[model samples]
Target: MGLRRLAATGVAVAMGGALVCGCGPLGADGASGSSASADAAARALIAEASLSFRYVGDSHVDETMNQQLEIKNATRGSVAPVLAFTALDKNHQEMPQVAVTTVYGSDRGGLVVPYGTSWDTLRFSGPGEHDVADVRVTVRSAAAARIPAGMHDVKTQALDSQGHEISRFERFSAVRLTNEDDFPVSVRIAYILWDQPPKGTTQQAVEVTSVGGLTEVPAHGTSVVQVSADAAAAVARNSNGPAVSIKAYNSQ
Candidate 1:
């Protein structure tokens, strides 16, 4: 069936349940059944779309090196997906010619796919019902250090075999400098420092605050907090970079 027709049919089936929700005599059971059917239809619709993109790894910066992009074809049909990575300076200007690599599959190769595949790999078969593509881009010292140092935005786009854009991913990174004395530091200080758990992750709220460190700093001593290197790179690529407010308090 044509893509449009298939999509339309999926939508009709999905909405059929919604339409029957309040008008049917089946009552609660009918509503439940409709909801389930609608959910299944929606998943089918998503699969029919053939491709999805997601960003993985750390969004905060410290000293460790980690960053990744995951591209998946959830549809039963085969699909070829391409990824484009763009790095922006603090002012949001595109960085020219960044070196990027794409790989596929893990050590054991369970159809999970690897990273940095030559064009030949693109022709390989994906998982029966799903496939994943991982892309890793390294920012050399010049690019990493010149990232404009603050809050920055990173944008990624995924394209299909026909060169049609399928999905776009965007994320913000804030880089800041942190010290031990103050546990909950603001994001404006250095644009490269981050607390554990990240900002928007499931455990972010619980991790951003410092829980078991020395509460007080000496009058003339300096305390420190660890920052994620990846987070800093992200902030350097955006217009805002990262901002932090420094305040000094005297503990009696």
Candidate 2:
């Protein structure tokens, strides 16, 4: 299905008033200081919505071959872009398997890209690795993009508080997210797997890969989200200390 169709039914957005910021006096531009700041932030988000993709080769498991597409979101806004992948055989013809699979971001499926400089790895897999000679990925502009809110209010920690396994797959693989607000919220989390601890505000890791997930948290409540087993394992094998980043935002 096209991204538009999936986005229509996939995204569950709560539309409300304009962005809530400081409500002080209006500035020379005839806008409130808070509103001006909000406007600048929004403009940054829209400008940085440009997404770049890098084909990182392919990996195989049994009879399937999985192609990797690394996506980077440079903006501080949440973007849900449509990702389409195709596999072609040596004959330059579409593989016998499904030619196209649409990866659309949604609240339920955890496809939204949250704020800050972030990278996400998307895998496209199909049968018969030998039949697949080439893989191609295409990215579509996000139909809806907005600066995420209440990001700093969301706190996260590894579920493995003790020397025990928190996830069914691995220890400390699941994340516990706490919402301090009085109302319910939708949470988007990105697990940045860094080969080394970051230095200052700069990303100092030699190797980094990110996995993201989304879920709903009740008012003054917390939620436990399980990271992808394969992705977590990959991180465990590569990183000494991985960081769990969380954000909460309301869409209009």
Candidate 3:
């Protein structure tokens, strides 16, 4: 059976209105200004409707293949909505990546969630029409034991109640290794970002708690990688913060 396309859903009921503001910071003492800034940075990144993903698939699993779908806004007046990919492993663990694209379809494009937006589906826009930009399927296993040589079924749908096909790209397999077994193996994540600061800004660094550990890839295995829509915002805020720096957990 074909996998069901899950619709993206929304979070807020009202737009542009500041509801109840939380009380003073919690804990033994109020949060420091820097800590508040850091929290704000994290919250900003998290609030964006962007998506994120490991370039080479889940680090916790021993899979050798994965897939990714991305969309960007190409016009003004329209905000780029966040794109999300929820991977349901056979084991039932839910893996989610949230961030924006490194590359926007146009200069005016940046992640946007007009009030009353839903996260149940992928939405795209342009001056007049909408479309999907890229669809990538990765083979991240040892080259020797590459995915079975045959046509693998592939399909992509907007995670909206009203299924939409923004755009479709060619499907092909490429080889790469995740090195999930702790052995040394070379892996690379190639992606574009929207409104990425000049390289110099990225040079400014910060420290962040390790959210998860890297998985060791076996000598002959592969893993897939993809970026989340909200990742761009998170990366931008974290790296561009005044004092502390934030790094994408797996942005190597």
Query: Largest lDDT belongs to which candidate?
Result: 2
The TM-score measured for candidate 3 stands at 0.17
**Model 2: per-residue Cα lDDT over 1-252, one tens digit each:** 000110000111111223223233344689956686666555433533455555333322222112234455565556655455555554546655644332223212235554443333332245643344444544432433432433334666655545343432234556676888676566665443312212211111132233445567777888877657665765466433333222233322
Q: Against the unseen true structure, what C-alpha lDDT does each candidate score?
A: 0.24, 0.42, 0.23
After best superposition, candidate 1 residue 82: deviation in angstroms? 3.4
Whichever of 2 and 3 has more lDDT, that candidate is 2
- Output the worst ten-in-a-row residue range by lDDT, candidate 2: 1-10
Instruction: Please report how far candidate 1 places residue 195 from its true position, in Å.
Output: 22
In candidate 3, stretches whose alpha carbon ends up further than 4 angstroms from where it belongs are 1-24, 42-119, 125-252
Candidate 1 lDDT, 1-252, residue by residue in tens: 000000000000001111111121233455546775565444434432443444333324442212233334333332222233333333434444433223321111111211221111111122210111222222110000101111111112223334444321112221112233212211111121222333332110110111122223222333333323643344334323232111121111
Cα displacement (Å) at residue 128, model 3: 8.3
68-158: candidate 3 lDDT, tens digit per residue? 2222212222222322223332333332332122221111222222222211112222321111222121111100111111111111111
Give per-model TM-scores. Answer: 0.20, 0.38, 0.17
Clashing pairs in 2: none
